[model samples]
Every structure is written in C-alpha cells, then in structure tokens.
Target chain A: MMLDNTWFVEKSYFEKFAMAWKVRKKLHSEQSKFQKIEVLQTESVGKLLLLDGKTMVSEIDEFVYHEVMAHIPYMVARKCEKVLIIGGGDGGVVREFVKHKDIKQIDLVEIDERVIEVSKEFFPECTQGLDDPRVNILAEDGIAFIKSKTNEYDVIIIDSTDPEDFASGLFTSEFYKNVSNALTEEGIMMNQTENPFLDEWGVGKIYKNMRAQFPHVQSFTAPMLIYPGVFWTFGFSSKKYQGTQLNPDKIRHMQSLERSLKWYNTEWHKGAFALSNFHKKKIGL
Target chain B: MMLDNTWFVEKSYFEKFAMAWKVRKKLHSEQSKFQKIEVLQTESVGKLLLLDGKTMVSEIDEFVYHEVMAHIPYMVARKCEKVLIIGGGDGGVVREFVKHKDIKQIDLVEIDERVIEVSKEFFPECTQGLDDPRVNILAEDGIAFIKSKTNEYDVIIIDSTDPEDFASGLFTSEFYKNVSNALTEEGIMMNQTENPFLDEWGVGKIYKNMRAQFPHVQSFTAPMLIYPGVFWTFGFSSKKYQGTQLNPDKIRHMQSLERSLKWYNTEWHKGAFALSNFHKKKIGL
Candidate 1:
C-alpha cells in the first residue's frame, strides 16, 4: 500500500539524501485498499503521481524511463506478441507496447485500481493505450498473478514500485524463479531495479539473485530526472536471447514503424549496456 | 567569494523544481571579496563547497564532474600542454590535469583564494595537484586574466561557477571571443553548460553564442549526481579538430600512465557525445 504524503513539500529520504519538489497544488489524495495515492501539480515537473510518497511518474521525464523499459526488450526480442505488465497502473509502459503493430495482447496487472483511475484523469497521453481492444486490465497482486501463469507471456515488464511495501515479494529469489517459469521459451523479463547510489536499497543483491534464476541476466541504467536517485537502473533477464545482441534490422524496422521517440534510439540502445566503471564497481560486474 | 548557507536543508530552486540535501555540519563559511563561500558536510554528498549559494564542487561525486571536464578535452585534443583553468579554485580541475604527463604548464586563475584554502583543507584528494611544480596559481579575476593572454594556452577549461554572481562574464559572447584569443591555433575549450531541464538557465543561448566564437561546437551530457539537475551538459568548442575524433593509441598510452579512473573510458568517451534525442530537440542541434 502507498504511504501517506505531505502536500506542500514532497520530501523523500533516499538513503542519507533528501530530494524535494515544490508543489503548486495537490490535485487529488485518497486512501485505497492497496495503497495511498496522491496527484500533485508541481511548479516545474508538471503533474506527478505519488504512490506511498514515492514519485511513480512525472509528466516531464516519464518518456526516458518508460521507453527503455518497454522498447529495449521489444526491439531485442525477435517477436513480441503477448505481453504482461505488472504494477504499471499509470499505463505508461502499456502505451509504449501498443506502439508495436505486431503485439496482439497486453495484460496489465495492477494491484490498485485507483491508480489507473487517477492516471487516466491526469496523464491522458500516458494512458492512451488502456482502452485498446487488445489490452486487459487485471486488478490483482502481480506476484500472485504471475504465479498462476506458466509459459504464457512473450514479454514481461515489472514496472512496480520499490520493493519495500506491497511490492516486496516481487524482488525475492522465489518470485524471480516464478517469473522465469512464467515466460515462454523466447521470452525476456524487464524489472525496475532500484538505484545503486542508495546503498541501503540492496540493488546488487537482487541482481545477483536474479542471475541465479535466469540463464542470462544484465542490468542497464538511464537517467530518471525526478527519481530519488537520478541515475536509475533496470534488470533484464532473458531465457533464449542475450540482451546485448541486437538485430539492427529489427531496430531499424521498428524505428520506421514508430517514427518519433524522445529518448530511446539505436545508438542509445547499444550505449545503455556500456556500464560506467563506477557502476561496474558498485554492482560487482 | 561564497555565499552564506543554511546548515539544515540546503534547498535550491532549480527552475520550477527544488533539489535539496541534508547538511550534517557546516565545516567552514566566510565572505571573500568576490562571493560568499561555505564548506558543508552533507549527509549523503560529502564535503560541498558552495559559492554564491551555488554548488561548486562536492566531495562524494566530484570526480564525475572534474574527470569529464578535464579528460574529455585532454583525450580528444592531439596534444594538451600549457593548460589554463579559469575559476576552478577548488583545484579539482587542476588535479585532473596533473594526471596527464605531457601537460607541461598549468596556469590556474581563480578570483577567490578562500575556495582554494577550504578545498585544500577539506578536499585534499581533489586539490592534490594544487602544489605541483608545473602549476602556477594566479589570484585574479578569470575574465580579466583571459583577456590579457593571446594564443598562449593549448587547452582552456572554463570550470567557473554558473554564469551568475562573480562569474557572470564567462557566459557572454565577448568573453567567449576573449577565450578564443587566449588559446593556440589547435586549442580546444570545455565549458560547463547548465542543464536544459531548467529553462531559466538558457543553455541553448550559451551554446548558440559559443558556436559563433568557434569553428566547431558541440555539447555533451553526463549525470552529475549532486548537481541541481542530474542530467548536466558541457559545451566542447574546438578550433582545428572534431571533438569526437580520439587518438586511441594516445588514450591507451595515457591510460598506462594514469591507470585507475572512476568514470571516463574509451566507450564512455565516445558514448558521452551520442546526443539523446530529447536533448537534441531542446538545444536545436
């Protein structure tokens, strides 16, 4: 469940550092069964969706996070048809997936239904694909939902909150095993690993455990301007494909189909894997 | 001169967004002739030097900023000697210069002397090369210092504070032309350009102005974890060579000389110039 948030100064103590945003107005606030949610109009970053006092998505820089989360796996996988997105109630991840014409189905499993409602009202551009005929919105626990399915989804995107509250089980070794079991032979899973800058978050521990569960595991980083730690990381685990080996033809073709993108591109896709030496030492790569 | 700072939450209103760090202790504070200077021990980011209420350098992640500022120019330029560092009284930029064995002379012109003394006392690692035999520390205004030199330095690093307060003259076209006159025919200049995320900073305006003063101009970005905006930019203006053209053999030989580095590498060196589409559009590149 989301934590209660203060209205004026949204301060988050990420490790020893405190990141704050000046709020113009509190658009909405309510306590749902699953978590507390708040929508805020900020002076600079436009609208913000805070789940448990944590910035889930902001209107200004959401594209950088969502694009890498969705497009990196899609462009790498030979064929991405049936997709599964967990905890992305804001619909940003789903919107990125709907850009591909070949994707037949997308199942968005969000634990809280209220997040979807608020995002639909506030972030219309981010939630554009929520009403697609091929999309299904399932209100349930993502960990339990993935446990129920086996070898069904072609691509799995774990766009969940930090693994501290309701999403704690999603970061465990057993849940990763279940995620490995739930994917098809050629499927790849993309999970939002926390920032390494905050050592208390134990991102390296989760990455090490994921490596034990999957045949191929790698991590990539991108800058998320509003996130507690601006340099954010993502965990990419694959069953049959190496995340680094990209089919340039496929990426070019995808670029042709979905022409305009703000952040992700062919060069950035390749460069994302070139982990900085500082990060290499931090993650023990 | 440095500015007085609050010892609790060091709040900075960057554009419409606010970035803050929790201060553990105020190590030192004084008013220099030019600006206000404060040395702060932050909870997360170690020893921070604030000039005119702006972050000049922080101990924890200062390497990221200084390394890129110095190494990018050194690695790209065919041969870097007789270096000029303007406004880097903290000696972080000079420390990077000392790593290159070929650099014969380093002329450090700093407007404020207290910053150097504070840095030597608090950030010894960053100020290591301040006492090197090759270094000549000039206690004078950087804008006036550069105007007096003509075709004298091989590399010019404008490691000044933001183009505000005492360093406001560094960002003007006339100052850039003076900087151009102070460099050799094959000289290259690296200046700290502010983030585009903060529209009030006018990084695009500075980039356009620099383009008029130099034959070739390009801007590259890197994540400065403790800066106001994490995705920070640096402007690279050249006279004779493209900034991206690197002598790999020279870098390899330099790596043999200076072995351990936290951020800069051959891959990252090239990737740093790979412009993000979002940034390209913002800067009208």
Candidate 2:
C-alpha cells in the first residue's frame, strides 16, 4: 500500500498531532449586566482585545466588519462633519471615522461601560484613537439617545452586536425610524446587521424595513473569521445617497489614509458591493 | 442602560445561540481520518458535497479548490475527452468534470477505500453519478497508477490533501513531472495546492516550480469554509491551454449539466477569474 510509512504523510500526521497543543483555550464570563460573554485566545487570526475582556477585534485580516461599517457611511455622506456611533465601545469604528479629518465631532453611545474599559485595556492598538478630543463617549442607550437627537448628525453608525437581548432594539423598524429622524436630510446610516450565511432572512427583513424609512437601501457583505459564519452582511440606508453612486474619489481618499492595509483596499471597496448573483437577485440590486 | 430585558434582543440572542449550536455540533465535525468521520447532518447546496467529517473532504465548502482544479483544465484544453481524477474520493470534482458531456471517460484513482465508502454512505446526493458507466474507480495509489498510464488522459486532477504526509508525494515536482508525462500533448493538470491564507509562501513556491515544467502556470483562489484557514487556493499548469480562452459555448454547455450549484454559477465563473487588483499584480494576471 502507498500509505506504508511515507515520511511526508507521517510528518503531516505529527504536525496535526502537535496543533492540538496550540489550539487556544476559551474562557466564558458573566458580566454585571447579566451578559454571558466568552473570551478566547486570539488564535492564529483573531487578536486579543488588550483593554477589555468583553470585546475583541479579530486581527487585521478580519477587519472587514469594522471597515465596511465605518467606510460605507463615510463614503456616502457628502460632508460628514458630525457623526454618531452607537455601541462601538471597542473604538475601532471611531478610529476609522477620525480618518476623515473633517469629522469635527463624534458621539459614541455605548450602553455598557465595561466594554469600553475592557477594550481600552485589551485592544490598545484598535482603541488608540479613543482619546481624540473630537470623540465624546456616552454611556447610554443608543435607541433613546438617537430618539432625543434632532437632525444634527451627518452620519449614524449602529455598531451594536447581533440582534440579541440588548441589541434587539438596534434591528427594529422603530429604531430605524428613529435613526432616520436623527440624521440630516443628506445623512447616511449603516449598521452591523448579522451573518448573512445563517441569517439571510433576518438581513432581508432589515433591508426591507430600512428601505421603507429611507429612499435608498443597500446591503453589502464581507468576510469575518471570528463571526459564527464566514461572511457578515451589513445594510446601509439613506434619504439622498444611493449605493451605486459611491463616490470613487472619496473611496480613493480613504484608501490613501494608511498606505498599508492587509484587508480593505480600493478594489475591495468596489468588490464588496458586488454581491453574489443570488443575493443580487434577492435584493433586486 | 437600554439593554433592559427586551424580547426582540432576546429572540435575536436565541437565534444566534442556536446558530452557534448548529455550527459546533451539527454543521461542523471535529473527526479526522485517524479518528472517526461522522455526519452530524446532510444537506445539499447544489452539486457540492457538504461532508461534516474532517477527512472525507476536510473542507465543507470545496468550491474554491474544486472549481480551480476542475475549470482551469477544461478551459485550457479546448477539447477534453478522457479525464482522470485522483483522490477526490468525495465526488465533488467528478461532479464538476461530468458537466462537460464531451468527457468520454473519468477514471477516479483513490487509495483510501474508506473515503469513497463513506462518501457513498453519507454524500449520496453528490455521489449520485459515481455508478455511471463512464466512470472507472481504481482503488489504488494515484502516483503508482499515474506512472503506469500512457498519453491517454487529456486532463488529470490531483485532488489530494495537503503536502504533509500521505499527500507529500503528490506535491513534489517529481509527481508533477509524472503528471506532465502521463498527459496527452494538449492536456492540462490542476491540483489543490494549499490554503493561501496560511501558506501563501508554500503556494508561491509550488507555483514557481509548476511554472518551470509547464508552458503556462496560473493560480486562483476561492472561499472554502472547512479548510484550516477560511480561504483556499489552487494552482493550474498546462502545456497547451490558457484560462482566459474559455469557450463561451463550452461554458454554456457545462452549465446545462443539471447539477444545481450554490456557489459556481456563470456570474461566479466570471467573477472567479476577476482577481483582486492586488492579487492580479502579485500573480501578474
């Protein structure tokens, strides 16, 4: 038999045996907020959130979730000077948003103070720009915060978790209406919807509701390794801006920001909007 | 704190929790060839094989590896009649190859009788045509079997595992030389090289070596969920065919094969070749 003591095959078997040792251990913790959150070794791809145990951004290769959530609105809004971020306690979103030097003020509404504290401690690299004077961190409910606000912000990003307990309101039609009310006439809103691979129906529902409130609704997908599914889909809605009218110049400007990015690049910005034929057919894009 | 007990968030949380269960327990399996291969569930997403076992087709999403390994050869050789698939015991590649009615015969050389045995037992839908008269199954080492063959095969697919143990010989330039010698003058060869996300260096090295022997050498990437890294890449080399010269009629004919595929649609066929500008520059596409 060809399988007789082949050195290469045997070495592979040995390597597989050794990998069992390298697999990281996972730890689960229940917060004072009664949230059951689990933390694990960042592993080969995910990064350890140095500041907080409650939240961690997977490594740069998995930054599609953050990049799309931030860039889409920044690209759509013609003049996004004042922005509001809801529940992005990790500060990665703020870091991407501040890239637009024109962003004079940023209001980050995070309900859990612990997520910010944990992120500040564990994910220093991702949260480095949190101290920027333009950012005002508000530990409050995002829905309530948006409801009280007038048409003051140029862009609003709902960077909340999956539509679970505390995050459920973020997915509601009422929340979307409130978001529409909170944005200026030309404002654009983007939300971290969920894993389309598993929750296509849920994502479709969100897209439909957002369409009802906003004149233009678009959904885009990106790969996220840390998420339950391989791909995470996000939805964007605007009264004035259309997704197809993506300003190439603004995207090029964003691409020139760091000169070095492992994941998001110019081609990706355009390609990310190019959905699978199935999705395109479904969304009528 | 807006996170107060909300039913919508609760429902979303349960849905996400249930998806986690499905991924950990039902969708993905931890069993290996040395251990035990189990089918936690069975579902079809076109002509693709969704094996839950770690070894059968180590990756659940085999489109990336299978598509490049299958399409490149068919694209290169304008007219391919006799095709040989070695070690794709799961029948995914065979399903792709059978798309062209012009393929007169497909000889599947697989050593681990257990692979085909298990595939037949669990992946009945994908393996539906294994018993077709045009297919010849050789329960033997692919290397030995290929060395004994003459210039009869028009396309040879080495659908083996990683270049670690049993699959080590398959990766050697020597095995490729054998493949080159076994093919007809106009024949082509394709193989699942490695995970580009984890082994770009290794893939680059293999691509370099393949370029030495074949007049044409190219590599393409596709997304596969079950691989060590989420994305997988495959290398294609041939003495006579170019991937860009895909005959429109031939592709249309291939699509006519009633094997419904979730990922490999005509648009995907076009998009698969649409490399990222960065990758295109790297590969000199």
Candidate 3:
C-alpha cells in the first residue's frame, strides 16, 4: 500500500489576473507493497498547475521548463526523428516532441511504470499523447537502456527530477557518457540542470562534466513559477550544432506553434539565451 | 492585542560564493494597517529590516531602489534641489536625496511614527543620515502633507505599497493632482510600482493615473532580487525630463558602485527599462 497523500495549493494574484499552483505528495509508504509516488497540487507566487495529489506536467505561468527542455534540442538537431526521453513519464516532453511532424519515433524510457500510470489517471491533459503509436514506452533503467543502444537516437532529453533518492545516479558523469554514446554524431541533448538561484554551483558542475564528453556546452536560465526559486537553468550539450543558431525554417515552425502557450514565445526564446553577464562570466560564455 | 502568528519564509541563494536572502512574511492581523498607511515591513521581500513588522528603510539593497528612483529624477530635472518624499518614513529616500550634495533640503512626510521609530532601531544604516540638518521628518498623512506645500519640491517619490489598504488613495487621480501642485514646472515624480509579473494591472492603473496629471509618463522595470519575483517595475512620470537620457556623471557613479553590489549593475540598469513587448504595448509606450 503506497501512501496516498497529495495536496494542492493555489495562489492567485489580482494584478496580473493570474494564478499559480504547486502539487506535492509523498512518494512512498513503509506499509505499501510497491514503491509509491504521491503527488500534490499547490500554487505559489509564480507557478500554475493542475492541482491533484498524484502528478503534474508543467506550471502554467512558466512553461519554459517543458518548452526549452523539449524544443531546444528538437530545433537544433538536423533531423530529430528518432528521439529518446528518459524519465519524462508525465508525457509533457512527448507532447512537445510530437509537434515536429518529422519526428517518427520517441522512446520514452521510464524506470517506474507507476509514475506513468499515475500521470495517466491524475493528469489526463498532460498524458494525452503518451499512448500515440509513435511513442515506445519502455519500463527500464534509463542508463542501462541507453548503454544497450548504438547510434540510435538523434536527440535525447533528460527530464528527471533533482539528484536525490532514485534520481541520484541520473546526474553522475557516467550517465552522461552513456547518453553521449547512444546519440548519433550530430545528436543534441538538453537536461534540466537545476534551479540556478538555488543551485548555481550544481549548474556549474554539470556544465563542467558535460563539457568533458561533448564538444559544445551551454546553459540557459528560465523562470519557473512552479519551482521554489527565481529561475531554473537547463544545460545543452551537443557534438556539432551551436545551440544559439537554429535553422530559419525550424525557428519559423516553432513560432508557428498554434498551441495556446502561457509562456515561451519568440522573444522569450531569444531572451532565454541572453544570459546575465554574471552568469556568462561564471560559465566562461 | 495584536496577533503574533505571522509566517516568515526566507529563500537564500549563493552568488559569488556569498549568500543572498529573499524573505517573505505573512501577517494575519496587520492587513488593515498596510491598507491604511501603505507600509508593510514584515511582508516586504527587500533586505530592509522590519521593526515589530512595521517600519522599513534601505538595506544594502536600498542603493538599488534609491539610486534608480532618485538619480533618474535628478538627471531629468537638471537642477533638482528641493524634494518631497511621501511615506518614506524610514529615511532611505532622504539618504539617497542627500547624495546629490547640491540638494538644499528634503521634506519627508510619513504617516506613522511607529515606523520611523522602528526603522531608527533596526535599519540604522539607512536612517543614519536621516538626522541631517537639510532633512525634515514630518509625521502626518502624506496626501494632506502634500496639499499644504506649494510648488516647492523639485522631485517627489511615492514609495508606497499596493493599492489595497492605506495606500489605496495613493493611486487615485486626486493624489496625482496634488503631486502636480507640489512639484516645480520641470519637476519629476517616481513611484515604486508593484511587481510587473504579479501585478500588471496595479502598475497599469498607477501609470494611467499618473499620465492623467503629467505630460510625459514612462514606466521602467527594475530587477529587485529580494522582491517576490526577480523583477519589479517602477513608474516615472514627469513634465519635462526624458526618462532615457541619464547624466554622464550619474552613469559613472552607478558604474563605480556596481562592484559593491550583488544585484544591480550597469547591464541591469539598461535591462531595467527593457520591458516585455506586451507590457510596452499595454502601457502604450
């Protein structure tokens, strides 16, 4: 029996006419038979979400987390048809990937089947496209799953959580090396580094480690309303493409995204890359 | 008896290997007090100290808020010596005003004696220069205080809170008329508007109200790290000064002070005015 406790918090502001939500829940109970993942929905000064205590995809006020995590690499790679997503069982990344009509396949490697199952039940909006024919859901360790592949994925997105508990090994340098081996020569990978305001050093360390294996490395900070702090930083490492320059057609395609997005627009796309001088000095950008 | 059960939350981040704190406190009992008088020290996110949760003055972060609020007006007015501060009971505004050295005198009208006394205790760094001979601390209603003065003040800074309680009248058309009456022909007035991300309409209303009274109205966004969000916006309304052109000496002064700050710098100063296109369009700038 997994502990089933999730709470939702909503914070509404009158000025901007916007509301932010955060969902929090316990992941396990000693009395449960299988590992339990509890999700809660809550709102803060700056994030929005579907408030149910089981799973969440992205905060409404700040969608850069999902947008940049999925689109940066998708737009950078020459032809990102066969992509692999590790730990994004929430289906938000897959939903973003499927936007590219060119993407023929997406291998969603999730370790715990329970998270996907819970997301499907609790967050239908976020998991709507996970069962699409093009997506291949594999219940396995992402690291081992990557090691077994050869020149398989053209783009890889790591949508894991903080480097704590089961997600600990995911942040190791070894895991990045495995990911590098699994990608094609021109493949690009973008990972949710961590909160820059809270984890600047963590971001710095990841950038240093990613640079060891990849020829090009860059990090950009995006404001996340769901997260606790100012903005979250995502690390982009690639073998060929410079993350800043995107194909004009692809940029046009991204801009033409008809989806009603609350955040992440063209100006935001350019601004995301325009890092603060302090951040630039720290990363030697 | 006052309710003492207030929740204080602090978010700290490490930058340049030093810790910076952003704090938020919720008061269950003092909601009305903030509405009536326009100052809520405990709930403010900046670095200033709150004496018994009421009075506020400049912290180290005070320079960021004061310089932009003061220097902009001074540069615009060309020879601004006489100034009036509404609700700056903590004397932070007066301290920034005195930096001009040429300024003859400043009349600070604060409504609450408690706030000044408390600020004198907790925020000694900011209030230290408050007792200067050129400054006069008048404890009275800011609106009534302004009505009594003629075209005396060259600049006026309305550093009040949201238009929820005591500060509600500060956002009215009547207040703007009185502000106009109090300023010299080329005088300028700046108000510390609310968070642009959280309270756009609140700021929009102030800009609209100020525009009704002044010939030139411009709103600029400044990054105050300690605020609820990373950025806060300030509205500058004037009869003569162009908001963009700054005195070369003041720019140099700001540049020299960049090394002493953890947040505000020259890049930030320029970026402060770079509003989102949406905001620029909304404000009709």
Q: Name the regions of candidate 3 deviating beyond 4 angstroms.
A: A1-35, A40-64, A72-83, A102-104, A147-155, A177-188, A196-220, A236-247, A274-285, B1-85, B88-109, B113-117, B125-141, B144-157, B173-256, B269-285
- Compute the DockQ of candidate 2: 0.10
Task: Report the lDDT tens digits of candidate 1 across residue range B82-188.
Answer: 99999888898899889888889999998888888988998899899999999999998898888889998889999877777667789999999999999999899
Candidate 2 CAPRI category: incorrect
lDDT of 3 at B79: 65
What would the C-alpha RMSD of candidate 1 be, to one decimal place?
A: 3.7
Worst 10 residues of 3 chain B by lDDT: B11-20
Q: Give Cα-based local distance difference scores for all models.
A: 0.81, 0.62, 0.63
* Clash count for each candidate, listed in order shown: 9, 19, 24
Global lDDT of model 3: 0.63
What lDDT does candidate 3 reach at residue A245?
67
lDDT tens digits by residue: candidate 3, A170-248: 7778888888899999988888876443442366667777887889887776655444444467888898988766756
- TM-scores for chain B, listed for all candidates: 0.93, 0.76, 0.76
* Model 3 DockQ class: incorrect
In DockQ, how does model 1 score against the reference complex? Answer: 0.42
> The CA-based lDDT of model 1 is what?
0.81
The fnat scores of all predictions, in order, read 0.47, 0.04, 0.02
Off by over 4 Å in 1: A1-7, A10-15, A257-259, B1-7, B10-15, B254-259
TM-score, candidate number 2: 0.74
